[model samples]
Target: MTTLLQIDSSITGPNSVSRTLTTAIVEKLREANPGLRVIHHDLAAAAPAHVTPANFPSAHPISAAAGDAPEFAAGRAASDAILDEFLGADIVVIGAPMYNFSIPSQLKAWIDRILVPGKTFSYGAEGLKGLAAGKRVIIAVTRGNFYGPGQPTASFEHVETYLRSVFAFVGIPNPEVIIAEGVQLGPDARQTALDKALQQTAGLNAA
Candidate 1:
């Protein structure tokens, strides 16, 4: 059976536009593939601690930080689990909202969990070689203002580009992105952008 992992990183709970769009896409995916196994992870509700000295250990035993002795091991274990989940999945759907012209800390944490050395990728004689293959990813992004690459507000697009670039590092090329921008501009613009993004989701699901 096809396994799909759905992740939501928006702090706005269900009210987030990116979350709403991702939900719609997931619903469509479920309807289209009833045999699919779906796993939902909400990062906003369960924040992951950033990597630190203890979390980033060498091949040998290392000293632990106060109150972080257990956390260091737990963090590595969690990252391994996430990496396994990604390796087992056929598709992944992520909801992301722009924060300071980049991805949210929660999603970044998830990325750190999945992008591992000698697993998802490895060093090659030339540079790097991604081990992961035959997987697909869809990202739904929401922003307060309009932003598209080469547009006036393009700076806001850094998050989407960053995700695509990083995912590609693990051989997940051509990640689909649905953007809902100009939400905070006004009511009309918000509805319009959301509708457009929803339509894109519909097309993605139909495909």
Candidate 2:
């Protein structure tokens, strides 16, 4: 059976555009592929703690000292759990809203926990070889202003770009980005953008 990991990191709960769109995508996917197992991760309310100086050393497991510090041990354990989740997933869908031109802190924390060296990815003869192979990723991004076309808003789209690049570096490439841009640009624009995104999302085939 296909397994999907749905992650929503919006603070606005059910009202968030990204969350709604991601949910829509998941629903459509379920309809297309029956008997699919879905796991939801609401990161906004249940955010993983940021890796601090105390736990930072554990990020590099090989470089850490003989014994793990209390905080470092906690961080390692947390990361291990997340990595297990990632390894088990066949597909990952993320609902990410742009905050200060970047993804929310919760999403970043999740990424930090999952992207472990010698685990998710590793240095290869050519460069990096990601361990999580053949997994598909879908990202639903919501923006307050018009962030496409020739505008300064486009430059501020670090959230989507960063997610794509980082995940691609770890071997998940060509992720489908269904964006609801100009959401806060009044009702008309919001509806238009959302309608367009929905159309695009509906056309997406499972990878």
Candidate 3:
């Protein structure tokens, strides 16, 4: 059976457009694949600790000073679990909302745990190579204002661009992205954008 990892980073609860899209996308996937195993991680409810000197890569080694701290040891264990989840999943669905022109800090913290050096990517004499390939990634994005291609403030759109770059660096280059922009413009615009985004989710491939 295929395992799916569903991650929600929205702090807005029911009001988050990204969260709504992700739910619909997951539902569609479930309809297509019977007995699909899903592991849901809500970053807003239980945010991962930010990367710090105490729990950095060096801390994982017993000889490192930071490794002496009990807190650091526990942090390392948690990070390992997060990485394992990503590696075990065949499909990953992320709800990414734009917060001040970028993704939520909670989401960023979760990302820091998975982008491990030798686990997700590696460097060789030839060049940098991504190890975590073959997994399907789909991101649901929401922005208050329009920041799509050719938009006036497109340069400020960091959520989608950053996510794409991160996933590509980890070996999945062409992740499917569903976006709902201009959500805060007004009632009509918000509904219109949401409806369009929901429609896009219906077309996602189950395989």
- Best-matching candidate per lDDT: 3
For model 1, what is the alpha-carbon lDDT of residue 60? 16
**Candidate 2 residue lDDT tens string, 132-165:** 7788899999998977769866777788889998
- In candidate 3, which residue pairs clash? none
lDDT tens string, model 1, 3-77? 999999999886789889988988889888888889989989987677555654222122223334664676566
lDDT of 3 at 87: 90
lDDT score of residue 124 within candidate 2: 74
Instruction: Rank candidates by TM-score, best first.
Output: 3, 2, 1
Q: Report lDDT per candidate.
A: 0.81, 0.83, 0.89
Report clashes for each candidate as comma-separated counts: 0, 0, 0
User: What C-alpha lDDT, on a 0 to 100 scale, does residue 173 get in candidate 2?
Assistant: 75
What value of lDDT does candidate 1 attain over all alpha carbons?
A: 0.81
True-structure RMSD for candidate 1 = 3.2
**Candidate 2's error at 47, in angstroms?**
0.3
Give the higher-lDDT candidate: 1 or 3: 3
